[model samples]
Target: MAKSPYPVINPGGGPMGKVIIALVLIAIVTLVIKYPSDAARWVHGLGSVIDGLVDFFRTLFG
Candidate 1:
């Protein structure tokens, strides 16, 4: 079987990592859903950081 390019992330894996990722994703999604403008500004403010993260995921999954 081929290994996944992304980390072997078990959604229900270790409690702490799961919780943190869940909360971060929730916060991002909530911000986007509730306040699109603010979300855009926040992402802009953290421009490089956000870009790096996006790139990281794309690389991991691509």
Candidate 2:
């Protein structure tokens, strides 16, 4: 038998994985829609934390 030329999407998980991913996406969408301001603030705070980490690493190694 010949191997597939196309790439496989699922890494071999069953339908449960697809269902869980779909549910998580739906929940995220719901939260964003229900709390737009909170979501924006949370994202901004996350970006700040990531930026701080980058600065810390730069000082540590550079």
Worst 10 residues of 1 by lDDT: 7-16
Q: How high is the lDDT of residue 28 in model 2?
A: 86
For residues 1-62, write the lDDT of model 2, one tens digit per residue: 99889977766479978888899999989989999999899999999999999999999999
Give the Cα lDDT of each candidate: 0.89, 0.92
Give all candidate RMSDs, comma-separated. Answer: 8.8, 5.8
- The lDDT leader among the candidates is 2
Q: What's the TM-score of every candidate structure?
A: 0.48, 0.74
lDDT of 1 by residue, 1-62 (tens): 99888987676668988789889999989989999999888878899888899999999999
Report residue 13 deviation for candidate 1 (angstroms).
7.1
| Clashing residue pairs for model 1 | none
| Model 2 residue 37 lDDT score | 96
Query: What's the true lDDT of residue 30 in model 1?
Result: 92
Best by TM-score: 2
